[model samples]
Target: MRKTIALFVLTLVICSCVSATPIAVAEGEADRFESWNETDFLKDFVSNNLDRTVATAGEEKAGDYVLSVLEKMGYTTRKDNGLTSAKQRFDYVDSINGDANVGYNIVARKDVSGATEFVIIGCHYDNLTSYELNGEKVGGEGAGEATGVAVMLKLAYDLRYETLPFNVVFVAFGGNQLGLYGAEKFIGANQSIVDNTLLMLNLDSVGVGDYLYMYADEVSTKHEDFVYDLSEKLNLDVRKPPKDKKIVAAKIRDDSKLPYHHKGLLSENSLFLDYGVNTLNLFGYNWTGEGYGGESENHPDIVGTKRDTLSNYLAYYSESGQKKMETATALVKAAVTAEDFSAVMKESKKEKFDYSWLVSDKVRIGVSLGILAVLAAAAALVYVKLDKIQKNSKKAEDKSDDFQKQSEKVFEDF
Candidate 1:
């Protein structure tokens, strides 16, 4: 009985000692990134083609890659493009209207509108494989920008059939290495999508080992705040700068029609404002963009070199990176589905900050249970011994009475 009590106590103690943690659910996009293994792809891209120094063929390769994934995700080849001259009708239109061959904005559209709106998750996959100084490759080719394509494809494949509030369009913009041209092409052609787009997240130089720097034009103050708050609550190390006085002022006086929900410059001065959407830009190296400095300045010169490969992170598994992506995706899911950014932020903060006092509470419960069990068992044993003694004593007394009765009978007979 003591042994049973001890065993029960031990089990209770163990149960109290450990508590489960929440696991990650990519929802539907497992292939979007194989997490740590992504470094292998980065290494492969850097070793084979560190040539994003030029701005032409790099974007085409990236664009085609996006198209392939979109096709895999059930999006047909884009036939009606409004920005690129390739789809035009006349020589005049092609000449006066346009002049280059790199590639067009690659966007895949799924017909099913799970939500009334659309969310365009874009990534600038173009690279300067060879930088041209006046139509010639300058210095040398650079590390091609392919990871954006790789990551975007991963998302495309993952979200293909998964239920979502908004249908997603994966975009690979060319001319990013040149001057955000590919991104510009996409925004220009899909202007309507901009207004209707719930949010725009662009992945650049991702899939490598580096601090993921998230950026936003003047149109993303509140959204940025939401992201930062979410990240902090989760204890993630992401690069999101608080808007300085200047940035806030810029967002206020901007003169564009697009409504800036973010608490930045209210004026629509930049193209980001035209869409009424938020842009999350990723700078792979040097962190020249806003709210991105520190070690980023000391990192590799990813803008022009092929050094920005998966191997950049081969030595270390980046928990920080995964947390960033997961958090961002969760944020998008919340804002789009709930139509409430504040609500999502609050909820995520609660979840991220919440701790189950499981370890402590369980310990107390276990100890209490063990003590009670031990006491109860000891009482039962004592009761059993007492009952035995009482029974034995009763039997002896009855024997004595029987003997006495026998003697009295003998006397009476005599």
Candidate 2:
């Protein structure tokens, strides 16, 4: 029975495998997400705000920038002395250099289902800070860091409209370049909450708008396969993570217990592994992690540095491909698939399903089976009837002949 079910699942998988081209429907078909565009609200948001990512830790303006975006997306805002809202909160990491210095983590979630499963997707919004040097603010802004924030914004906006498989918390963390302070605080305060999380995807930098990069291990292949497969179908430039980084996951090894932040640590992200969730953490880079999922539209050298500027974040990065936008969309679609966005769409919007072709293939397969079965049954029945008729006819002929012979012999004798 299990084998039969597995075969059926395999058949369904083949039938549902995402195609190179989006499915074509007759006129007036419901819009299936062929190209899941990530440029909805966040792109606009990030393009405008990349400069602020380099602001000092606990910068009110930087925190507010993220806050405004969340509020626009319909989330209630909360603020504490060391916190802002559920989405934006404060933390002090002394090791990273701070008193009760302020840093914010903006968090928000869409309540799709009960908290049976929880997936946390996050990115650091704070970039490398500008330290005062020689009475002048030395080059402010971390290289590659602003791009990370921009990508996070884009992701946050994308998730706002998406129907998620589980309750997805979008966290905008601060202080990654500075000893992972922001991430540590968030994870530490919410260790139990983090533990309950099913999956976590950390998008550090997503789009130079050229190619896609995925970071994962063998355990993440199921999720990674979806991305790679989609990339193949789209013929896009999709790259993999470096060898050392691949082993990193949702939990890590510590003195006694596995720390939250290790190659396999839930310290910050990779929550997706808990619930079999798939995820990726992209960073802005030049040649290696170039393009959309690799590097955002930011200069890699200035990332995690104060020298980072808006110019560092806005140039459209393109490699030889279809139009940059088209390629970017393709990569986004692939990530969404690996992220299980399609499932969310299908399950959440079940009412919108197209009933026309819902069972068309099944009906067609059934028709073929039915026709062959009927033909075989008819052939067998016909052969049996013909055989019986032939035998009966021979018996009658033999009996009649015998009678005639006997009668003739008796007449002759008499």
Candidate 3:
């Protein structure tokens, strides 16, 4: 009886711990995050009926919305005009018109006097074409990545007035669904800006999932620590991929883990990765390690569909989820505001070069040939060994047959 009572007490304790609410930071530089209105801004921002298609009215309106928010925050905003050729290269052109279809990257800058290095925080505001399970064309909507756009807006607002150790640029990419065209263009044209950037944080699908995920790489330890610190404070679940595992956005269903290929950049962060930029991707939803059962925007069927609206997300996740998003926003803010973040990113001046030609065809061809040669050598050795074994076995069988025949004849004579 005493043991049973003790077990019950332990269960209650664990439940209480799990149910505990996250409190705002009472002291320190990150305390401004406590005042952030996470959902109010997000709901209004995402509510805009922006279709995510490249070069469409919805895309333009969405870009305008991002610019409006940044301008309200008192940041210098501009439409980067250099990515027109990049849009052409990606084949994001209209069928009716022969002109190259392109979307502008709304770049908002917060310059710090005497600070040479800058940080880039970006997400795609454009939506994708919705399709049915049978691959039939259906009506498209702006619900999928609206949450990500909201997150960027909130970040701009939260950090607008604060002076930091480095300059900051908040960029909303236009042609993400059309193969990361916006990001590709930004990288191509702004080689100088890209060089000065210390880190790039990409937010996507922030409105769903039970756990916060930080897709990290070798140079993003400071970013990882910031998210982890937030997790500890809020008692929120957080996950990072193991070193050997690929840094990817993945989907997890009941008992199964599948990789989510975003079609462009494979994942939005890959654009920066291809350029060897320091990057960290923050999103809600895990379905990666140990498998999170909580569903969020990472759901393949839900995101980029008409169903990914504000009402649906709120109803599906409940008010607590919004609160969680607030916490997530706070954590990201903390990371951005951390004093030591800029110190780790010092680098020599970067020369202007087209990253499109960064990887030569000859190098790719050489690597492919090397792999093919190794595979061919392995196959040949395996075939030779198998052939020798088969020949030896056949010889042994023939010898046995001869002996049997000789024995049979001997027995007949006897």
Candidate 4:
């Protein structure tokens, strides 16, 4: 009886310890970002074949690679060659249009279920004149501009199986280094898409710095507050300069300021901003110059140099890549799940409950105790049954021994 009780207690203790462990759910969704490795594609983008220069054979190779990937992922891809129209509309398009070879804008479109609107995400794939360590202009292929392309490709792969509420269009703009010609051409050709675009998120050079910078001019959509709120929700160190200030293009020595209402002065998101489409230009580098009361060197230098290869920036790639992935994930989640930016930002302000804590020690202990009680009762029932069987077996053994002795005594008397 004492042994049965001890065995029952031991069973209860074993069951209690097992119950306290975290439960694994077989139906949980897999993480999409984990499978999307940025460096593997980055290597291909920076290879010698995809030289990414203006009107070069290498540029065509890069465009072909992008198109192939989009097709493999089951996206409807198209090319936008609006440079002829760009030349007719703007006087500044003369320099870039000199080359008879047309610059192609690779666009991949995916329609979401019940989506009434479209979200255009873009990045420039063209690289400017490569510079040396001493700031000397050199003639070579460019890899600095490839980072944005790599990021966009990763986003497309991660969101391939996702069903969002808004149509998503991923664009790789050519001739971006010449000017914002590719963006201008896209806007010129896709008038209908521009009109219904819910937001335009531009990814440019997101491989360098620790900080994530989002730029919007005065004419851009009123998305500063929403972006700030979203960044806080995702825990990204974001820097968004004021509209009245000039910081975005100061390091590059361009007129990429907020009051860029002029067609000649354009960033990648210029036309979208001009047409009142909500635009967010996500860059990892921050420029600190006279406009922001500091020197340009105070900020981390941007790509566009020969040294801006994958090997050079590979050290911090994981950190910057994680931030970009998190930002994209949060933005897409909010866009797909929310009715408007206001609702998204408002929800970010609410106190979010961490359901992960449910499996922590405190809750686990309570659950373990309940499970232990039930297991103890079951163990007690099992012990009583086994104890009765043992006693009955002993009684049967004694009866057999007595029968054998009686038979032997009868045989001896005979």
Candidate 2 vs. truth: CA RMSD?
22.3
Give the better candidate number (1 or 4) by lDDT. Answer: 4
RMSD in angstroms, all models?
A: 25.7, 22.3, 14.7, 27.4
Model 4 residue runs over 4 Å out of place are 1-34, 48-50, 76-97, 113-116, 129-141, 219-222, 242-244, 247-266, 289-302, 315-318, 321-336, 339-414
In candidate 4, position 189 carries an lDDT of 67
Question: Against the hidden reference, what TM-scores do the models get?
Answer: 0.52, 0.53, 0.70, 0.60
lDDT of candidate 3 over 93-179, digit per residue (tens): 422233456567777777766777778888877765442335763434544356677777778777776778777778888766545
Candidate 4 local lDDT, 1-414, one digit each (tens): 000000000010100101111112123212433565655556656663335664555555566567656555555323221110011111122242343344667777776555566778888776644422256654233443466677787777666666566677888887566555567667766767777776787777665554556775443233556666766876766677534444233211122223223211234776565555667776654344434322123333336555455555664455565565456545545544455654542343232222344445787698899899999999999999999999999999999999999999999999
**What lDDT is obtained when candidate 3 is compared to the true structure?**
0.57
Q: Is candidate 1 or candidate 3 better by lDDT?
A: 3
Q: What is candidate 2's TM-score against the reference?
A: 0.53
User: CA lDDT of 188 in candidate 3?
Assistant: 68
Among all candidates shown, the one with the greatest TM-score:
3
Instruction: Looking at model 1, report the run of 10 residues with the lowest lDDT sum.
Output: 1-10
lDDT, candidate 2, 170-250, per-residue tens? 677764444444555566566555655544566654443334455543343444565566778778765665444422222
Runs in model 2 deviating more than 4 A are 1-58, 77-85, 96-98, 132-144, 208-211, 218-220, 242-279, 286-300, 315-414
lDDT of each: 0.44, 0.45, 0.57, 0.54
Model 4 has an lDDT value of 0.54
Report residue 136 deviation for candidate 3 (angstroms).
4.0
Off by over 4 Å in 3: 1-36, 50-52, 76-99, 129-135, 138-140, 218-236, 242-267, 289-300, 347-369
Segments of candidate 1 deviating more than 4 angstroms = 1-37, 40-58, 73-102, 134-145, 207-210, 217-220, 242-270, 284-298, 306-414
